[model samples]
Target: MPKMKSVFVCRSCGFESPKWNGRCPNCGEWNTFEEVDALPKSSSSAGKSSARVARSITPLKEVDLSEASEVRYHTGMEELDRVLGGGLVKGSLVLLGGEPGIGKSTLLLQICEHLGKEHTILYVSGEESARQIRLRAERLGVVGDGLYILAESDAQAIADTVSSNKPDIVIIDSIQTMGISEINSAPGSITQVRECTNLFMRLAKSEEIPFFIVGHVNKDGAIAGPKVMEHIVDAVLYFEGDRNLSYRILRAAKNRFGSTNEIGVFDMKDNGLEQVENPSQMLLSGRPTGVSGCCVLCTMEGTRPILAEVQALVTKSGQTSPRRVTTGFDFNRVWMILAVLEKRLGFCYSALDVYVNIIGGLKIQEPAADLPVAMALYSSLTDKPLGDDVIAFGELGLGGEIRSVSHVEQRIAEARRLGFKKCIVPRHAIKSTQKFAGIEVIGVSSLRQAFEAVK
Candidate 1:
């Protein structure tokens, strides 16, 4: 028997230390170190020996330079496929991280069901049983003979199963839940996560197997694992949205093979995760007519443009220092916009409690949303509603000047498709577009011009 050692690990960043400390030096997080038993060297050595025997390496120049036809396995969900840059590529490792109950498992199972026909998919769940997965599959109406489920957490066993079955794709329900028998650290610990991820990475690269791993989000909403987990994977995707809403947005934060900024839209249904074909249309549904505090904005999510509603409400505050509350939009940004309105437009909202919300549970992070947010606030303050057919989007400067936004053409096209008859855009955008059919484009250089045109 080999001797067992112990180490201290940071919970926040997965930084490891040989001894305990009050502060984590790597991440600067206080009191995050937790002690865990370390794996015996002999056990890890045995695994390494197996890996070396299983894998063969060749020189870069010695490899054939033939141009092999690219193969894509569709996940049966168009939205997911689009986000993955068409479909899953061979020998790729994708990491999907999100909060609990964010439908990570559901989405992957749905993908398996969709791809089970043409591809042999191995669905390994460390946290759930085969019967539990079958029940969910039944609920999703996805009964396929090609989809195989294994409820196991040991990494060695999983590796053996993958080698024997030769699956086209493999999905680990979660990497954190997987415990390597060779590693003495508990499952979800830093050492275990690092070891398991390394194994999966080697498997994907050596076997030319495309694999997906479901990751959990920490309290700070970041992927819960060692930083190396992200570095080891080919792509890192985040599934984010309010649990209260039916819609969820999947965005690629890091991609080695494709664009990182791409996004995919999905709606959580009772049956399973359903891809939202036209997100703009679904977001604009149930929009109130003739609302004073409402304005339309076109915001870009990755390469796609989505038209969303921005709503603001201003009322007298009973407390000292009027409260500023914002949903889906940054609160500090709202304050900055209010200050700009007071200085440039001569509107004082200091005595009012302002509340802002981006409709449809969509978060607006782009500065282009500033124009519509300001318009909505102004409309509420003055009790005047803008035309229902009007759509506005542009970045607002502190001096009241309108700033140009990226991908203006896509925004305009989305507005046109959604039947928005009038558009208020930056002056710079107007110079670029010669003409757009069936829509009136109003270009403004400053906030005053925008207010006048809408009024």
Candidate 2:
């Protein structure tokens, strides 16, 4: 037997040292070093040799393209399928990272349940036992023979199971919890995460099998582990949303086979994750009948248009400096609008505390939401309510001018579908032959013109 040595490793950047220090020299993060025992050189060598033997590589151009049609597998979830560019392609490795209890496991389990009827799926969980997973499946009302579960964390054992089963799809509950015996570091450590991800990548490519690995997010909302882990995967999807809200968003940050701008929306339910086909209806529900601080806005997510409610509150401030707060909307952008309101509209908002919020917990990132945000603030200050049948959205400039927004046609169509009788948009957005039967489109180039038309 060889003697084991101890070393200190930094959790942030995976920097290793023989002695501990107060600050990590590599990542500059304090109190992130931990001691771990090092494995013998012989064991490490054996593991590397085994991995190479299990996986094979070939030139991309030399490989036959005749079997391309058989490489794709449909998971039966339309939203998910869209995000994945139609379906899962064989020999592709996908990484799904999110905050705790963000439904990473639930979404993957649902996919397995739906695809298990036609194809075999092996689900490996390093953090939970078979009985625990069974209970969860029962609660989710999932039952299928083609879906198999394994509750082990050993990398070698998992590889062996994959080789024997040769299933159509494999899902690892999380990659951080799995450990390689050849690595001296504990599970969830940088060394272990890197090695396990490499092994999975090898298995996916060599076996020509599609694999999904769930990942944990750090306190800063970033994917846990070294940055290299993200580079190794073919696709990286971020599952994000406020835990207090039932809605969750799955966005593709990186994709080798599809567009990165695509997103999928799901509502958390007692049974499982339910796809939200018409998100506009849910977002516009429970809107106040006649509110001074409310406005409707059409925003584009990817290629789809959604109608969302914008709310604002303005009141005289007692403090020396008025406070400005915003949720689900940009803070700096709100400040910019305040400046415009004070200068262009001749409004005295400097003495008032302003707050803004987007209804249904949806975050607005596009400039198309700018007009509604400004109108909501103005309506609150003036105590004037906007009409229920009117919808407004456009970008605001420093000169108090309205700018054209992308996908204007889709926005108008969505508003028309929701029974909105009037729409205030940029002049450049209106087409020549574009006319709705019952709805009217008002085009404006300046903020003053928009306010006069809406009033």
Top candidate on TM-score is: 1
The parts of candidate 2 lying over 4 Å away from their true place are 1-70, 220-228
Which tens-of-lDDT digit does each residue in 87-157 have in candidate 2? 88888999988877999999988887779988999999998998988888887878956899999899879
Candidate 1 segments whose C-alpha is farther than 4 A from its true place: 1-32, 35-70, 218-228
Per-residue lDDT tens digits of candidate 1, residues 129-193?
99999999999888865899999999889988998889999999988888889676788876677
Clashing residue pairs in candidate 1 are: none
lDDT of 2 at 312: 95
Report lDDT (CA) for all predictions: 0.86, 0.84
Candidate 1: minimum summed lDDT over ten consecutive residues — where? 219-228
